[model samples]
Target: MSPVTYADIEAASQRLAGVANRTPVITSRTVNELTKAQVFFKCENFQRTGSFKFRGAYNALAQLSDRQKQQGVLTYSSGNHAQAIALSGKLLGIATTIVMPQDAPAVKLAATRGYGAQVILYDRATTTREKLAQQLASDRQLTIIPPYDHPQIIAGQGTAAKELLEEVPQLDLLLVCCGGGGLLSGCAIATKSQPNQTNSPSHHPRVIGVEPEQADDAKRSFYTKKLQTIHNPDTIADGARTPSLGKYTFPLVLHYVDDMLTVSEAAILRTMFFLWERLKIVVEPTGALAASALLEGLITIPDTKIGIIISGGNVDLQQISQLLK
Candidate 1:
């Protein structure tokens, strides 16, 4: 498989221009004091459709051939990507079908349907979303737009990091929440490919991926130097509970990412609340994974300029109340 390159990311950025939200890079003095680092958060939580997935989904849909676009698109995702594809398809006047886990967050499910896509709910414990999506695509003649697997998707996701680096050119480290290595790999490619505007050759940031302890496939893959899988990890970070990394994303992660780290579920919940309480931002558990690792002192490096990608803000309010209770 051909690797996604900086040029691809640049093209994606151009495609996403004026469409995808260039989300803000947020900072808090309290968070900086706690981590002892100058923390800059690329807040994708505020992105269009309230997640970074819109960038990739819109870019992928925008690139489809006119015939394929007329035929429509199909994909499988837990939540954010589902809503992304649905909204993007709606914007492009194309039809979309999404295979989602039945147990996905209620808010996400509702938002996806609200975006006008046909929703197919499956048993995550018993059925594979990938196989189901493929079969449906074959039957319906719909183009398969995978959540994190395609080069177009990866390139589109890289735009978040590209935008961030363009804003904060002197970051020493960048931490990204990893789910099948899509966002992390994309960010790594974008950061490593571009020259920092700071004029310091050594100022290139070290990119690290953060995942849930229960869903640690990416971390295991990084350490073992091979692909790894975890079957239906029981974690609250539903977005990170992917079975494994994708073929295309795994290689980019291995080649460009510096390291992978895991944070405990407790830390994830704590950080979610912290972001809500302190940052005045509503970050979903999966989105908070990277920030959790940093807030909990999981990353050893300190007193450095760091960038953390807060992946999304979609959360079920009722579920949040239950979890808090």
Candidate 2:
């Protein structure tokens, strides 16, 4: 598969200018002091639909042909992407059908439905959501907007890193939470493709992907130099529990990403609580994946300016209360 180009990311940035939120790059003095690193948090939790997925979903939906838009769109996601597509479709006046896991968080399911999309729930263990969505799209003449495989989606997701790099041009490293590698690969492209304002030739920062240890498909793929799959990983980071990377995203990750790391469940919970208590943010488990790796000392790089992509803040309140207790 051809990689998503720098030009694509530039176009995506332009497309998302007023549509997607230019989420703030937050900094915490306590966090900086604890890690001894200048940490810039690209807080996508503040984004539309409470996740960076809005950038990609809106971008993809906006680019649909009139006829395709008339036919509407279909996709499958656990939570964030589902809400993203639902809200994007609602905004674009396109009908959306989302096939979500039956056990998906009730908050996300309600949010998706509240955005005026048809929700179809299937058992994650017994049903292949992609195949079900494909069949539905085929039967209904709906355009299948994949959660993370398409070039348009990848480019759209790249806008986050584009905005980040534009704001903080001198980052030493960028760590992204990886599910199907869309955000990781997209951010890698955005970061590596552009030269900073500085005249130095080595202005590009290293990009790393962080995943839950129970759902380490990207980590395994990075190390094995091949795509890998896992089935139904039981983890608190539900958004990062994807089975494998897609074709478009896998190649971009292989080519542009520097490393992939996994963090334990304990680390994930700890980091989530830390962000909430210290950073005063309600970062979901998946959103805290990269920070978990950093706080847990999974990556040993020192004294450098680090940029972390806080993927989302869509957590179930009941779960949060239980976990906090």
- Tens digits of per-residue lDDT for model 2 on 38-58? 999999999999999999999
lDDT of each: 0.92, 0.91
Q: Supply candidate 2's per-residue lDDT for 254.
A: 90
Check candidate 1 and list the clashing pairs.
none
Ten-residue stretch with the least lDDT total in model 2: 194-203
Error of 2 at 272 (Å): 0.5
Local lDDT at 46 for model 1: 94
Give the TM-score of each candidate.
0.97, 0.97
CA lDDT for candidate 1: 0.92
